[model samples]
Structures are given as structure tokens and as C-alpha cells.
Target chain A: MNVTDLCGLAPPEPLERILVWLDAAEPDEVATFRLPHVPYPLFDHLTLRPCCWDTTEQADGTALVRIVRQ
Target chain B: MINPEFSLPLAVPLRFFRTAPLWLLLAGVLFLLEPSTVLSSRHAPEALALTHALMLGFAGNIMLGALLQVAAVVAGVRAARAGLAGLMVWLGLQLGVALLVAGLWFMQPLLLQGAALSLSLTLLPLAGWLFVRLCRSPACDPTSTGLAFSVLALVTTVLLGSALVLVLTRGAALPFAALLRQHVLWGSAGWAGMLLTSVAVTVVPMFLVTPPWPAKLVRLLVPGTFLLLLAMLCWPVLMPLLVLPAAALVLPLWRLLQQSKRCVDPARWLWAWGGLNLLLVFGLSPWQAEDGILDAVVLGGQFLLGGLLPIFTAMLGKIIPFLLWLDYRRQRPLAGPLRHMGQLFPERWLKYLGWLALVAGLCWPWGGVAATAAGGVLLVYALLLLGMLRQACCKAVAALVV
Candidate 1:
């Protein structure tokens, strides 16, 4: 499992890091992303790629997204 | 696993984005030609044309495109053929806005009639489709709910506008003053204001990294504002109540700005400016109905241009560059060095334009030489933004080859 903690980062930085990670990952590799919010736009972006992600809201108002490159 | 339901093409919104600056430039030209129109009574023919140019041509274009994008993202509303719908709406707006502006500018009844027909045909079906989709959407979030109400307001606005056109063109014995007032209210506060608030609820937090607005307050805002508008319409004496929502938003915006951790960008400052001007609009609203035509015109200009212009300009600056970057990433492999958002468009240029727009909006109400000078400022601002957009697109396309 790969973890990319993206808390405190703004906008394109977080999105950019995730894409770079996703692009380099092997098939079926799972990655977890800790984000400032639920990242709905990321969900929209993921539709174009062969990836599945589940977002879980944390008690502290942040979000954890688990993504698997399929 | 979340189902990926939205796959709207970037081109869907890009077309509208590209076309909008031209309309703003056109409004600038009209203002330059007749500076008095900027501060003249709203009933003046040139003033009417100029208003439509900004409202229907510039702002309407941006909002329609944005609505499609936002609806897809927030509500998971998928269009059957987004490209085709986008094209149809784009063409309709081009034709309708041109005719409406020319018709009013020249005081031609026939052209006004045609403009009314075209705009109605284009906007009504689009609004209906969005409303239905929003109703059936699974997402019950505040953004989605607010979008739904805003669409309803848009429908009401368009209908009232069409009726006003008939009165103007066909001499339909309607109370022109009353109908025009209702049309402006529904269009300005009900449609544009509601939509801005809805977008802000999601955008401000996400982009600025500020604490989210209190959910309960966010939830109540759209419906509460809508009810206030309805009350104002039914009982004209309740006009002062308009200040409540404006005040609600201004306080929260001030709070959010203080809490934000993100580095300052043109968008944030523009939003602050927009919020401040919005308060001014509401503050000045009660006086509009009482005696001062000049005050009324200035208030109209402030609401239509000052109140929303900065916010829209800010969104354009933020959104376009990001969209360009996203498009480049989607089309290319990640092997090359990733392009940053700032590289697509210069941050300083946006900063400069933001200040310029502020100056233009401030001087616009003064009329005479000041307004004309402001018009020149707007012309330069539009040209700069248009150039930036073009350069950004060209750069993105160039990256495809490298």
C-alpha cells in the first residue's frame, strides 16, 4: 500500500501529486490519500482512468481516499 | 467504490469560456461610445442594450457553461449529449444576445421580438432539463439543492423577460414598470445571486482551504433568500429586507478570509471585493424605488457589474488555467515534467486585471469623463484577459507536440 498524505496542500498540488503517483503505479497497486476535503472533483477526474477510489470522511473534517489502479 | 458518473468533456465549457470575453469587450466598446449609458436611466435604449450585452452576453454565457460543469460535478447530472447541448445553447445565445442588443440599441421592435423568441427557446429547455435532473439527482447536498432553486429562479427570470419583450415590442398593455422590476429582481437576485452563493459554498472552501461554512446556515441560505425575494415581489414595501441575505454573506465571507491558509491569489481578493460590493448593492436597493434615477442606475450598474463582475472574473482566472492543465495531463503521459497552473497564465496579469476591474467598477457610476475613462479601462481589461486565454490555450496545445 502506498500512502500520499496531502493534507495542508492547496489545489493543483494535491491533484498533481496524486496523478503523478497513479500514473507511475503498477496495475492493482493500492494508494491511500489523506485530503483536506472529500475531493469530489477528483472523483470526476478518476472516471477517465482505470482506477477505483473510495472516500471516507474522518471525524476531524478531513477525508481519506483509497485508490486502486485496476 | 464510487461510480464515476460524470465525464463531461472540457470542450463543453471551454467554448463558452472562450466566447464570453468578447461580449465583455463589446460592452466596454458600447460604454466607451456612450458613457452616459453607464449612468443613464435603465430605461434608456442604449442602457438597455448595454445591460443585455453584459447580462445575457457576458455573464449569462459564463453561467450557462458553469451550470453544466457544476451540475455534472456536484449533482452527478449527466446530459445525454453534452457537446450538442452546449453547441445549441452557445449558438442560441450568440444570436439572441446580438439581436437583443442591436434591437434595443436601435429601438427596433422586430429585432426585439426575434431576440425574445431566440432567448426563450434556448434558455427554457436548458433550464427545464437542469431542473429535472437536479430533482432526480441522488446528491442531496446544499450545492445541489441551491442549484435546483437557482434554476427555478432562472426559469422565472426568462419568462418575465420574455413578457417584458412583448410589452416593449408588441405594445401588450402590461404594466411595463412592474414587469421590468420583477424581471430585474428575478434575474439579478433570484438567479444570479443564488447561483453565485451556491457555487461559493463549495468553491470558497475548496480553493481557499478555509473552514467550511456552517452546514445548517449553508442549507438555509438559498431557500431563505428565495422566500425573501418572493416577499419583496408580492409586497414592494418589504424591499429593505433584501439587506438581510447580503449581510449574512458579508460577515461569513469576512470570517472565511481570515481563516484561509492558502497563499493570496487574484481569485480570493476578487471574491472579497465582490462580497463587499454585494453589500453595497443591498444597502443601496431601498433608495432605488424612491426619487433618485441616478441612484437607481448606479445601483443597477453596481448589482449587475460591480456585485458579480469581480467574482466571475476571479473564477475565470482560476478555472481556465486549471482546466488547461487538466486537459494537457489527460492528453499526454506523465513522463514529462508537469506544468504548473501559474505557467499557463501569469498570476501578475490576473492581479493587475483584478485591480483594473475594481477601478472600472468604481468609476463606472460617476458618468461623464470618469465613466468613459473607466470604459477604456474595461476595454483594456477584456483584451488582456482574452489574450491570456488565447495564450494559455496555445501553450497547452504546443505541449501536445513536445
Candidate 2:
């Protein structure tokens, strides 16, 4: 699935869940499913895929997470 | 909702250390000097210098630093360069203020204009940038909204400030006096007024353990105040038009007090009393007597800055201790948590000081002796606060060491 499919997921919390689904997909298929908008640095660092979510998503999300880069 | 304890961020502590004392000192000096020349002469240099001292030196620095720290914490945006930005702003502001004051005292209009313009220009972008970042933050609350309004006020402050400079330096063929009046109105009512109101809404309720006030007051009053101020700017001829908006803006605080839970937080009580008294003093002056305007202005300044601001300082006297205790307790949960808030500062002393200052201000209208007594009482209060701050710092240091 492309980033657009992920965008359609609507909320940030569910998007994390969807990332798991994508990760569980065949490696080749998952490799082909690029998150177009996410920076490569962030995409590579994430266990699944990273998405650019807005403030409304942040306010509505269940958990707060901070991504630390090494 | 997140634990209110953890809601306040680390930057706040740093800001408190840096900015709070400076404000107190400026407030003290203004109280002592009683610059009759500045007040009566309408000398641009004297008036502008005093204005900048209060606005930029005392109120602006504290508010800017505190707002940045609070906004970052509340908005959950780790300011990428807050430390450096803060330092730069502080240094530039201080240097600019020193030069501006010197220029004004010496009657060097060029230097005054240059310093004022430089200070405003340097700080404006930082304030604007900070506000934009805050707007993008995930957590937007009443405090944040109040801060956002303050930022807008800062912008207007800069624009009018620069205009004042141009008029002073080049003898610009514009209505300089008209512009100066507008600048004062916007700076005093828009910038200082809004920030103080916002702080009151968030802090008074928190300290009082009061039920949450409706956010509508903040939402309506902040923007409404700005819009009205903007309207006044457009029609300078309608100077009297300001009275309606100012009263309307102050109405929410009256309502908030009616609904406040802890009627006994001596500091908050004094603040409510002083604020209402000043409002009435100013509100009624238009009808009763023209000569009372100066007295009203002085009394209003005392109430707002002297009375209301100190209430917050006293509140901080409690808050800082509690925060220090919490910070320590987090490290060692069983170390016999630091003394209760009551033990940290002398509440009775604060109450006495508050009463003395209020009484003196009220009586000053009758006799100069009362005004002198008020100044002395205020000086004592300032020294007391300094002593408490020093003690708190020592305790905090001990906690860190242990």
C-alpha cells in the first residue's frame, strides 16, 4: 500500500496498528510499499512506517511518543 | 488528561530563575523614583523611556521568557534552540533598554530612537516565530491561547514602537502625539493586559483548587480585546471609544472572582480586590472628575503591577517550593519530602505587605505622607521577597546536591 492508503486511515493511533499489518505483509510487497511523504531518515528508523500527522491527531491520540535519533 | 504535576515543563524553572527577579527590581525602581517629570511633562523621551522600562524591561522579559517556557511544555514542542534564543533575546533587550534609558535621561533623541528600533526589531521576529511554533503545537489550552494573544500584542507593540522611533528621530511629518497615545494604549491594554488576564485565568483557578472556568471568556475576551484595540487604531478620533472595550474586557475577571472557589488564598483575594478597586477607580473617573485621571493612573498602576502582580509572585512563592519538593521527591521518594508549602514562605507577612501597600495607595490621594509610606512598605516587601527567593534557591541547591 502507498502512503495515500495510510492517509485514509484517518487517525494516528489506528495508523500504528495499520503499520503492523503492512509489516506482516510479504517482505517484497512491504518493500515496494513506500511512504512517499515521510523522510527517508524517519522511514528507515521506524520499525514500521512513519506518517506526518497533524495537531488534531496528536490531541486525539491515546499515547504520546517521542522519536529519538541516534 | 495528563497529571497537572507533570504538565508544567522543565523550562519554567529556568525561566523563573532568570526573569522573575528582574521584574521585581524594575517594579521597585518605578515605585521609588516617582518620576513626576515622566508622568506630567508628556516629554516623549521621559514617557517613552519609562514605558519601555515597564513594558520591555519588567513585563516583556518575564512574560516572553515564561510564555516560551510554558508554551513549549504545554504544546509539547521541544524548542530546538530555546536556550540560545532566550539568551540572545535577553541580552539584546537588556542592552537596548540600558541605551534607551540613557538616551532618554540625556535627551539624546537619536540614540533613543536607534535603541528602541533595534530592540523592537530584534525581539519581534523571535516573538512571532515562537508564536507560530506554538500555533503548530499539539496541545492547545487556555494558557496557550492567552500566550498566543500576547504574541500578537507583541507584534503590535513592535510596530507602534518603531513608528514612535521614526517620529522622534527624523521629525517625521505624522501625528506623533496621536501615534504615541495609540502605542501606549496597545502596549498597556493589549500586551500587558492580555498576558496578565491569561495568567490569572490559568493560575488563580489552579492555586485556588477552583472548578475550571469556562474557556469562552478567554476565547472571546482575548480576541475581542485585540479587535477593539485594532478598531481604536483605525479611528484615533474616537479616543473615548476605548472605555467600553476596556470595561468589557475587565468584566470576565469580575465574573471569575464571583465563581472562584478559594476565597481565602490571601494573595488571590488581594489580587481580586486590588483589580476590582483599580477598575472602579479608572472606570468612574470619566464621570466624577477630570483631575482624578493622574491619581487613577497611579492607583491603577499600583493595583495592576503593585497589587495584582505581587499576588502572583506570592503564589509563585508557594508554587516554587512545591515544585522543588516534587522535583526532589521524584529522585528520592522517602527523603521526608521538603516542608509543606506553608512552611516555605511566610503567608502572614505577605498578607500584611499586601494590606499595607493597598492602604497606602488608597490614602495617598489624601496626603503625600501616605504615598511615602506606601513606597517604604513596598520596598520592605521587595526585600522580603528577595530573601524568600534566596532561601528557596539554597534549598533547591541542597536538594540537588543531596
Candidate 3:
């Protein structure tokens, strides 16, 4: 799994970058993103896309969101 | 289908943000009418009108709008019938504030009575609803805790304010001085102060790209500030201690701005102005006006215009554009190309507005020609702000149609 660290980038940048990455990924390819926190609003957008994702709280207070293109 | 549980409709928050500038415009008009009366004394009817125009009208609208959106994000739960509830709250506030301002300006007891009743009905229910929602939410983060406390503060402030109205208009024999002090304390430190600090925890890091607030500060700031407010209520001499929280909130922003990658962002300048205002407000104590240096009116202006308005204006600049971008992005399939937030609103406009607001706030304490000019400048600021939001909304709509 490829891991992307998006910890310090502000707002829509994090949401936008991850969506762009997801769009270009191969089907069934899984990627994990380390975010500053749980991307609540991004969940709204992901609901519309053909993707499956799960978020886990990391020990360091960041959120690790793993996404796989469906 | 988008989950209604997780999604907030665009119209809900937009209605509030768009209406905020109108209140500022009203404040400008009141100032223009009689700057001397406004600057004369804090207890003067004209001064009270101007204060309410900013507080209940401008700041109230913005804070409530922000609460609707932030509550959902931090709590991970959307309020039931949020749209309808928001609309009702907006309408009630608009009506209540108009009556309150008119009552103060005209000195009509009947209008004051109506204002008291309308505000109590609207704010109590609204606070109660949000408090219940925050309490039920599983996410117990600092931001959520702050939101809950701010709601309680709003309740205390409103009750005190209503009591004041009765004393003034209904001839109720209450301890007017003590009630007024408590009202100012909770309204400023409890309601407005707490909300700003709590919201900053989320907004500063997410929008400004600052490192998260210190973990210890995040946990203690809200609860600790509330305790101090309670302490001040019991012992008014501890009122000066409230400055500690103000300093704590401002110091981190200055520190972060020094390290922020988006150093030139206009919002950063406004934050600096907000910090400066906090210093001036605390340094020039209202009680120290006995030597004829300044009065409570100037202190009030420092707090509202310099301290609160800048922060609110800067946040609106970022939030309005971002919200428009979000809405446009959600419909980009039909809208064709999505415009970024910067494209929706120009940063230069915000920069200009910030400078103008600073000028207005600085001139507010002086009563004569300077204040008159400040009134004119504030009117322009309000119009420019309103124009920016309207244009952004139009751009989003036009793109969707195209």
C-alpha cells in the first residue's frame, strides 16, 4: 500500500489532493493517507465516488485513511 | 445518495453569513446619525443601539451561522431539520435585533418588551438545541467541549440581558449595576470569548495551516476560561484575570503567523489586528476612566470594533469563498470546471477591507469629525463585504447554469 502524508497542508488542499490521487489510481489499488484529523467533509464526497475507505485513529493523533478504488 | 446525517445544505449557513453585513451597515448608520451620543457614554441609548447593532446583529448572526456548520463537523452529527431550524433562528434574530435596536434608539418601553420576549424565545431554544446535540455527540474533543460551554454562556448572557431590559423598561427594582456587569462579562468573556477560542482550535489549523494548538491548551482553555468567568461573577475584582485567556488565545496566533507558510494571507493581518485590539481593550481598563483619559464607550468600541470585528471579517473572507468552492465542486460535473476559493473572492479586497476596518475601529473612540469619517468608512466596508459574498454566490450559480 502506498502511503501519502498530508499532515500539515490546509483544508481543501488535503481533500482535493487525495481525490485527485484516487482518480488516477488503478482499480483495486489501495493507498493510505495520514491526515491531521478525520476528514469529515471528505466523507461526503467519497460517498459519491466509486471507492471504499476506512479511517483509523493513529497513536500520534493523526488519522490514517485507507482508500481502495472499487 | 449523500448521507443526510453527515451533510449540511449550502443554503443553511449562507443565509446567515450573507445577512451579517447588513447589521454592520445598520451600526454604521447609527454611528453616522450621532457619533457624539454614541461616544458620550456606554449607558446612553444611542451607544446601546450601536452596541446591539454589532453584537446581537453582526456578531450574533456570524456566530450562529458558524455554530450550525462547526457543530456538525466536530460532533459528527447533524442537527435534525437543520435547514428549517436555521431559517427560523435567522428570522427570529433579524426581527428581535431590529426591535431591540429600535427600542434602544427610540426609548419605547413596548418595543423593549417585544425585543426581550422575541430574543428569549429565539436564543433559549436555539442554545438548548445545540447544547443537547453537543452533549449527545460521541466525539468529545476540545472544540466540541467549547461549543457546549459557549451555548451555556449564551443562555446566561441572554437571561442577564433580559433582566436588564425589565429594569430599564418595566421599572423593575433590581440591582442594575451588578446585573449589567455580569451581562457584559458573560456576553463578552463567556459567550463571545469562548466561542472564538473554541472555533479557533479547528479553524486556525485547518485553514491557516498552523500546527495544532498545544495539546494541553486545547484541553484546558475552554473549561479553564469558564471557571475564571464563574470566579469573576463571584468576585468582580477578578475581572482583570479574564485578560489571561485573551492573551493565551492571541499569543499562539502571533507565534503561528511567524511560521505560517501562507504568511502574506490577508487573514493573518486581521489576526494581528485582533491581537492588538485585545491588548488595547485590556490595557485601557474601563474602570480606569476616572482620570478622564477614556471612558467605557471607548473600551466597548475597542472590544467590539477592534477585537471582535476583525476576527469575524477575516474568517468570513476565508469561509465564504471556501464554501462557494465546496458547493461548486459538488456540482462540477454539471458546472464544467471548478473554480478554486481564491478565484471566487479576491484577497486584495479582504486586505482593503481589513485596513478600512482598522481605520474605523481606531477612529471609533473619538467623537467628532474622525468618528463621522469612520462611520462612512464602515458603511463602505459593509457594502464591500456584502458585494463580495453576493458576487461569489452569483459566480457559483452562473457556473452551475453554464
User: Scoring each candidate complex against the real one, what DockQ results?
Assistant: 0.44, 0.03, 0.45
Position B16, candidate 2: lDDT: 41
Q: Put down candidate 2 lDDT per residue, A12-65, tens digits, no spaces.
A: 212233344444544334322222112111221143233321111232211232
Q: List candidate 1 stretches off by more than 4 Å.
A: A1-8, A26-28, A34-50, A55-64, B1-5, B289-294
Q: What's the true lDDT of residue B54 in model 2?
A: 51
The candidate that wins on TM-score is: 3
TM-scores of chain A across the candidates, in order, are 0.90, 0.28, 0.90
Candidate 2 is graded, for docking, as incorrect
lDDT per residue for candidate 1 within B1-402, as digits (tens), equals 655646467888888888888998999999878876556666889988988998888899888877877788666776778788888989998999999999999999999999989989998998899999999976677788999999999999989988998898788999888888888888988898889888888778766778888878889999998998888778878777888888887779878877888657677788888889888888778776523433776777777667778888877877777777776776774634446877777778779878987987787667678768777887888798788888989988887788
TM-score of 1: 0.93
The residue pairs that clash in candidate 2, if any, are none
Q: Rate the local accuracy (lDDT) of all candidates.
A: 0.81, 0.54, 0.82
User: What TM-score do all the candidates reach, one by one?
Assistant: 0.93, 0.72, 0.95
Which structure among the candidates has the greatest DockQ? 3
